[model samples]
Target: MIVTRGSRLPLYLAVPVVVLLAALPYLVAPPVTRTLVGLFALVVLASMWNLLAGYGGMISVGQQGFIGIGAYTVLLTDIAGVSPFVGIPFAALVAGLLALPTTALVFRLNGGYFAIGTWVVAEVFRLVTVEFAAVGGGSGASLTGLSALGPTLRGAVTYWCALAAVVLAVGVVFAIMRSRLGLALTAIRDDPTAADSLGVRVTAAKRLVFVVAAAGCGVAGAIIVLDSLRVQPDSIYSVQWSAFMIFMVVIGGIGSIEGPILGAIVFFALQQVLEPYGVWYLVVLGLVAIAAALFARRGLWGLATGGRDVRFLPTGYRVAGSQGGVSGGGSP
Candidate 1:
């Protein structure tokens, strides 16, 4: 593998930007802080979905199942007198554990069957959760456990948790995509049969990617409920979560890390501006997504960069020019 030095411009620009964003709760109004929390969640969701479908070639529309699991995990722990803040990591763990058995069953199918099977799994999770009356089942329940904190403190804590979750989610994806596992994933994605023949543990790689994506989505779910202070099966487990993730990934650029982040930002921006238009906002979102799919299949980020080798988080090794240093290695 050739070693190369990636552009340092993004890192140089991102450091202070991240620090500013981290201190946003202290500097901004409550509504702005709340919106940033939601934005962070979208980034985590889009990035994880990209890793799963783009790199792993495992298209799963059932991620909302894990999202709901995370939300409910927070609820369950809170009911047991634990702080909801403490429940976030536990939510991720439970979601990951659930993925083990779930993957074992769903991995039996391939192609479109696999996609449909995942959706079926999500529905199963939703239906079962509705049967559990302890968590308000059909009607859903509000999280009263956070009542002890002042409003300002609650918002700040939620925002910080969201920030941390996004960081972890992105970090994990970058780490995986830049490692030997990433190379194997690339081989498997391009040709699974060939990859298997070449000694790549295709099943293990897929399973690992699937579990990580689930855990990331799970953390996003927990953050969502933590911010909203409520969780309902209908809303938390809605196919809409997966739909948004797909839209963001597809419109931003499926295979690139920066693409999802860009797509999420665009989606969030559009949501903020067009939300008051009611149903028209949905129409607009659909049109944008369709346009992106039809014209910019690599996504807006790809288009913006002229489909070059530009990457905010570089994943693979590239050979260097004799007259120049390594061309494109990403920052840690």
Candidate 2:
């Protein structure tokens, strides 16, 4: 395994940029900071989804289930007199715990069945949540706990939390990809049967990825409540969140870490520019996703890099003198 000059570039550039972005709330207007909060949330979501489908070879379309769970967990915590801000990590814990039992059920399915089963489980979560009238049931509830803080302070804190979540989400995914577990996941992704035959703990690897991805999505969901100041059944649990994750991952590049970050930026920019067009915004997004799928099979990242195996965050190894490095040696 060898590290290249290009692999170190992102590390050098990321620090100063993260520092600047951390101070953005103080430097920028409320609206800009608010907009960035949304972007950060999207990056978190896309990264988590990418980890699950891109790396684990688990194409789950029901991640919104965990998102809603996280949002509601924050709301519940707030109702119990805890600061909603304090509930963010707790929400992630709850979501991850819930995923444990969920795996017992969904793991039974495979391929497309697994995907649809996950969606059905999410729908179950939504329906069960609707029955609890204490949480506003079919209606929704606004986050009242933040009322104590000044609007500026609240917004700034929320932005910082959202930023922290993005860093954690991407960092966790990157860390996993560089570890022994990453190697197992890559093998599992390429061929689960073969990976299992070769002593890779396929089920365990997939389960870890599933729980981690759920926890990441949980963080994103908690941030969503903080950003919007409300949690609704329809909006929070909407399959549209799943659609957005899929779109961002597919458009950006599915398997690489940088792809989702780049994809999130593209999706955020498009949303900002095209949102005023209302329904057409979705139309444009759908068209763009389709075009990327049809033309840029490897996604925008692959197209931009001319199909070369250029990696800013290399998760795999390069041979002593190989031309394109080892196959499945990059990110999953």
Candidate 3:
């Protein structure tokens, strides 16, 4: 048997799924289309968080900082005479650049302190954005130029953009996790001191992960405002963004790509059903997350998959026989 790290079966399955999703705009009703736009954005957020905390061993409650910044980037750039559509990438770039200095300051702490430090940094971003008055300050603002487009055209564009963001976030992560950098990330996550001693350049790998995760979150933030046509400092920068990400990653499975996808789906389903319940929905979500943490530490994906090492998006390495016969397997 040709041993592989990730299951080729998932790749085969993805072909038809991609085709179906591509045709979804035509097939689904407007409500479904809108729901999917939000869904894909959640996937992007959860995936980025998973990359940062699960693989890179950086637990950050501050990712909402990037999301708020990214949303503001879209709004501010649009105010500056750039199309919000074009500004999405620039938002990612700015968030990535900002992460360099942010990381420089926060990386000084370790363990739980590091986590708290990230939260503090995010609050600082939120507060700073509030003072900018032009972008609605703390009051928030609506995206203006989009109204020039017909409703149908704007919806279609936003839907497609959301789809693209999802693909980009997941694809970038899959590509990274399959490369040499993935190996370094795994080592660093597992044991930083050992990885460092073995010349793994732990700090560099963590920093790269930080930047990429920030960029991904930035793109997600842009997508959110692009679809909703509104950006608010409080709503976008709320710690709830980080909470949702942690819930998805933890309940789905932190170390695996499929986990976030599954987690987002589950979370979305709950949101749709229980949202009317207001505070009760949050209570339920918290209960579910606590249950997942206590019972299924590897997450629901781990429980569903059992001990089988099958992966849809394989990022790990495989040991193979020279003749492509039966052999053992391992992750990168």
Candidate 4:
């Protein structure tokens, strides 16, 4: 691989830039500002999927399990008299805590089994939520009070938090990957047996990634509930949640931070443009994903950057010839 002496910007500078970019809709157009926040929420979910699936070698189809946990955490906490904002962090912790046993169950499987196991977990959670009638149970629950505050302010707050979640997850993933743990993750991804032989603790690493992803995904779930101001166990725990995450990460240039963001942009843009087709919209999306997975390899950005990942977020440090061994060989 040809080395690129890439000059990375300081995270201090990048974080503010990303945060400002997230707030763009709030500043320029008060109307639909919340939509921008929603986009960031999707990015947060996508980032978690990317980290878990892309780097950690675990493709989960049931990440919504934690997402649902987060939503209910907020809803349940609000019922208990805590502020919803305060409940958000608490919700994330709740989700992470819930992840412990689920890991034991799901970890028993590998590859496609692991993926399917995740979906089952999401489904089970959905069914459990349906039994609680006071919270609307099967009918779902609303994020009532916050919805009454109107759009602009809620949009601003959610946007900030969503951006922060994305920033936080991405930053943590970047840091861990740059540190010794990052090296371990890379080794595991490349060859689990060799990584294990090197004493990298494969299962432990995967479990850690899963838990962190669960926490971030939980926050995203809270944001989604906030966005719709409602939560139906069925809707929140739908397998489509996993489907969308897969779509965004796969087409966005899977296994990389930049991939999900680009995929989200393209996914949303396509949705806006082709949504009139109803079911056909999904057909087109599937076809695009199929094609990207089969031929493009690195995704749309790969094509745009000539296969070199030039990150605007400035998250990690790439030593000379450190990554991207195939084809173009980076910035040269």
Error of 1 at 218 (Å): 0.4
TM-score ranking from best candidate downward: 2, 1, 3, 4
Which candidate leads in lDDT? 2
Pairs of residues clashing in candidate 3? 1-325, 1-326, 316-332, 317-332
Model 1, position 180, has a per-residue lDDT of: 81
The deviation in Å at residue 221 for candidate 1 is 0.3
Candidate 2 Cα misplacement greater than 4 A, ranges: 1-9, 321-329
Q: Please, what is the TM-score per model?
A: 0.94, 0.95, 0.94, 0.88
Q: Give the true-structure RMSD of model 4.
A: 4.2
lDDT of 2 by residue, 63-174 (tens): 9999999999999999999999999999899999999999999999999999999999999999999999989998989999999999999999999999999988988987
Better of 2 and 3 by lDDT: 2
Q: What lDDT is obtained when candidate 3 is compared to the true structure?
A: 0.87
Cα RMSD (Å) between model 1 and the true structure?
A: 2.4
Residue runs of model 1 more than 4 Å from their true location after superposition:
1-4, 7-13, 321-332
The alpha-carbon lDDT assigned to residue 268 of candidate 2 equals 95
Query: 198-218, model 3: which lDDT tens digit per residue?
Result: 999888899999999999999
**lDDT values, one for every candidate:** 0.89, 0.91, 0.87, 0.78
Question: In model 4, which runs have C-alpha deviations exceeding 4 angstroms?
Answer: 1-16, 22-26, 309-332
lDDT of 4 by residue, 139-229 (tens): 8877666755667777677766777777787777666655566567778888999999989999898888889899999999888877777
TM-score winner, 1 or 4? 1
